[model samples]
Target: MKAYFTYSCILLVFVLQACQSNRKTETKNGGIVKYKITGKVDFNDGMQVYLQNYDNELQQFQKTTVKDGEFILEGELVSDGIYNLIVKTDYKDKDTGKKSFRITYPVFLENNCDYEFKVQKYRDGNVIQAAEIITNSEASNNLFVFEKEVAKVKQTWDTRREALSNEAAQLKASLMTIGKGEDSKYNYAIDRMREAGKESQELAKKNPREEVSSLFVNKPEHRTSLITPYLFKYITINENNYARYWTVLDSLDASIQQHPLTIAAKAKVERVKNFYEQMPVFPSITPRNIKGDSLDISKFRDSKLLIIALWSSRDRFSKMDIPTLLNKEPQLKNLGVSVIYLSVEKKFEEWETGNKSLGLGLNSYLLNVTDKDFIVNNYNVSSFPTYIWVEPKSLKIKELRGGDPATPDFLSAIKKAL
Candidate 1:
């Protein structure tokens, strides 16, 4: 009886021990993973750390307190996937009293491992100092390891943009110096700046994959209407990004060009194309017009003189002059000249308003168009309110880009075209 009782006690103890071991294994794989951030930086205790998981959407996973130059970040690892951790040193500027920042290296968070982002701040006594970190990760995978990669690229872009802007401003200052006939160094500075701009552009082209504009646009959050225009602006500055800009524009245009009633994508395409026309050409088209009408540029073949006017509602000069030109419609008719208004307006309301205001002549037609392939490549309209005079008999382009007063050499080109 005593031996049987002892055997039962031993069996119960082994069962309990096995269950405890299973629980620890489960916790290690599927439960909360803890990370400790220790650094020797002289910042306030109020500093905080934020962690963002880079899935399809950047979901914030954890946050922790920065007390005594240390932080304990705890979060659940529901699955065996990689995550991105962002650590920001939150503080207020000493001089400005406004909110300031110092962020640490982004570390990749994987299951069952604690990663640290060791950062060293630049000695400069600025509100935000440059930082450097050495990590054992490749640049591509750094997306998971460091949130600062994006921020660092953004900072470098701003610095370069500011330098270019300052150089441009200095060029204007050079005119003043030259006017004074001062034997100044302004010309030399201007020459050096021009060379620097060329060098910068060459460098920008070499590493096309590293462009911030491309990275920013591809972000899932920015793949929408409101943000696309802003992205276009950034892409336009780097002419090497023409293909990147066109791909995005073409994709958006394709999605919405079918629904003429919905002006969101249509209008965006127009504005983007209009802006891009100033640069290299990448023309695309919507088969349908704003009035639910189909466009066939081939119909203009019979006219004796076809004046193609590339105008936009957003263009101040186009808005002002289109009305006057429409009022002179009778004069154009008597002279056997046909004027076609090519509107770049995106919204139906803006398009309607522009047409009604212009009151274009009997020989005129309003065709809503967008895409780089349509205007710059097909028609070669380089400037806004651009005028192209074609031989009515042959439909051959006789004059290209007759200027507006606001355009470079506007008066001279208009007189030549007329």
Candidate 2:
């Protein structure tokens, strides 16, 4: 089952204000919810704890204490959403001797739920394992799976590499003996031996049993770059983001020369290299309006600020965030900033109906562009809801894919352009 979760704005304002304060508040929601934190570290009595939302924007709620190996951070839950809770400590490591802090997994704060998250760090002589417990099910699962896979892959790769290096070196030395003599027969033998060695390497790669185990086995590391990059490339190709695929494929080619027979490693480099090569170039390409009227982007040359928002009618995020920007059109216009919407829908009729149903502003249009394939390959868009800021007079791109359009950072960027 699919579900859409919503976090209302009313509670966000109150929580945001408290976090911005230099001091920590011990009470919230008429003192109904309270929290405390404790840790061992050499620092002042107070530390800064940050609560971040998904947009990478900081909210106004924070915890500000870590004294006597314990602390108390109290606040009311504003809404249910994902958050990356971080604790900043001044404790320095004995080995590196560098001061550092740690991050906690997602802490879902449900409304009316008095949530308490415990943070712990244990040191076994010189080793430290930091852990946290929260009620966020999704974050816990994501962190757990990611940590396990990454650790296992690193361990397996390190061990297998040592073994492979020894084998490759031995084979190379054995094959080079044929080249010792100066005669033509010796040169032929050397070439034949080299071919034999490559055949052996290919045999090692074709062993499906070993390769399959590497992907699923709990112990031995099996996946190599030669194979993995292609997997990523396939996904990008399916998404019609050929530009990204070409770039990845090219990078893979260079790595293959260095790593030689490491299939997984080689594959990764090629995927990125291929991704870059597939990207389309736009040489002063003009954008078309909804009425099929071609409007050269250069026509906005007189304006100091030109903001372009690229989105599709079917995209749920665009549906939410685009309207938010348009709602503040009057203020944006007052700052001498101009905005334009470009559609990535396949059909012109789809774009028209979508634009009209959404009640988009005057500046919004269904551009001739269709789908992310055309947009991403041509413009190199890496993420959805991408905003491009252009200095029209100079035709130089000020910034591509600006800040989150739904947040205040986007507004700040627009004001700076004017």
Candidate 3:
């Protein structure tokens, strides 16, 4: 009997040990991110929090409802990447009834790690803006540090630019009043601007391996404009330059190099290469009209100057511009420009509905091409309601206009282009 009791106790101990071991393994292997928030704001049960992964074209978002100011998000990340936290709150206004406000924060997420964030909000009238991140992971700390440093540089640069602008303005005024040659003042301003730019470049070059370098490579503003000039100045495939420009990219971490921002940079480089190699002309496309008839864009090439409006049903600007386009049809025709509204709707039903409702008495066509990428890439259509003016004879793009076409400036630009 004594032997049997001892055996039973031993069996229970083994089972308990196995259960604890399994729990520990699951916690370690499973990519679970737990978050705790403590702040002055009132927390209600079931408040929602969202995590969005950064992407070049579209962001992937995940949501979880907060419970007692804490939430555990479960997902497996392939690699460490930047993520955004978004929280939205609705407040009932005494007069307006209800108003919604959003607060956002950027954080770095590593695979299989936990994070805690403290939300810091500052009052800006009725709306609240996220001011800072009090506590976060090491990666997040590094990213913020880089951002703060960049902000300081931008502030100093702006101050110097403003001072130069003031000096230039004064010089120009004196030249206008006192008659001629004050070109030296303008030259001095230009030289100062150049020097400031050099300083900024040197600052970035000083920390090429820092995680913040990813910001310079990936951030839209930096990659598109701020950093491109410096990069192009050094990068060459020729043997003489030693490919120093390419080495700047090579020095970055592999993860940063494979980031979406890096991908966008590569695309930009390819575009520049293609621009030099290919002729500047619009690609021929055959799409269907609302009445199910095929309309070849090439048919309009030699007939008259075509003003192609690329729009979608869901875009508010596109919907608003439809009426504007219809209103301006007579004027456009008078100027020898024919308008064609191309709907890039993904669904046939939505396109049909929009065509019937919004495109009444307009030359409207649905983008019926199967290869959507080809259309977007060839035309360089980044957003909806994009207007392109094509020359009648050469079939080359004369001008590209974005935003509301109904604006006076837009109409004036069209006339000027013609």
What is the lDDT of every predicted structure here? 0.51, 0.52, 0.58
Per-candidate RMSD vs. true structure?
15.3, 23.5, 16.5
Give the candidates in order of lDDT, highest first. Answer: 3, 2, 1
Evaluated against the true structure, the overall lDDT of model 2 is: 0.52
> In candidate 2, what residue range of length 10 has the lowest lDDT sum?
22-31
Q: lDDT (0-100) at residue 54 of candidate 2?
A: 40
Candidate closest to the true structure, highest lDDT: 3
Give the top-scoring candidate (TM-score).
Answer: 3
Model 1 residue runs over 4 Å out of place are 1-47, 52-61, 67-69, 76-101, 104-114, 121-296, 299-358, 365-418
lDDT of 2 by residue, 1-418 (tens): 1222234455677676665331122212221223333344333345556566643655546666656645555555443344566666555545754445555455533223333445345453222255655432332333344445656655665556556656656655765565545567555555665665555554444433234323432212212122323223223232243344344444443323232223343365455444344433323555556555665666677777777788788888888888887877677777766777877778878888878876774456655544445657656786557887766676555555666667866776676455
Model 1 quality (TM-score):
0.33
Model 3 spans with C-alpha error above 4 angstroms: 1-47, 66-72, 90-99, 121-136, 180-418
Score residue 375 of candidate 2 by CA lDDT. 56
**What would the per-residue lDDT of candidate 1 be over residues 1-418, giving only the tens digit for each residue?**
9999999999999987876444323322223444443443355355666666654335776677667756556666554234445555444455644455555344434343434444455334423364433322222133432244445665676678678767777776776657555545666776777876765665455433245545655554333222333333334332234455556655542322232212333354455445445442222223344455554555655655666677777788887877666665466666666666666666667767766666643433444444533566666555567776666555545556544434355433443344
Clashing pairs counted in every model: 12, 52, 0
User: 65-161 in candidate 3: lDDT tens per residue?
Assistant: 6566566554555544456766666655556443467766666664423455554553544344555655424445555665676667666656765
Q: Give per-model TM-scores.
A: 0.33, 0.33, 0.37
Q: lDDT of candidate 1?
A: 0.51
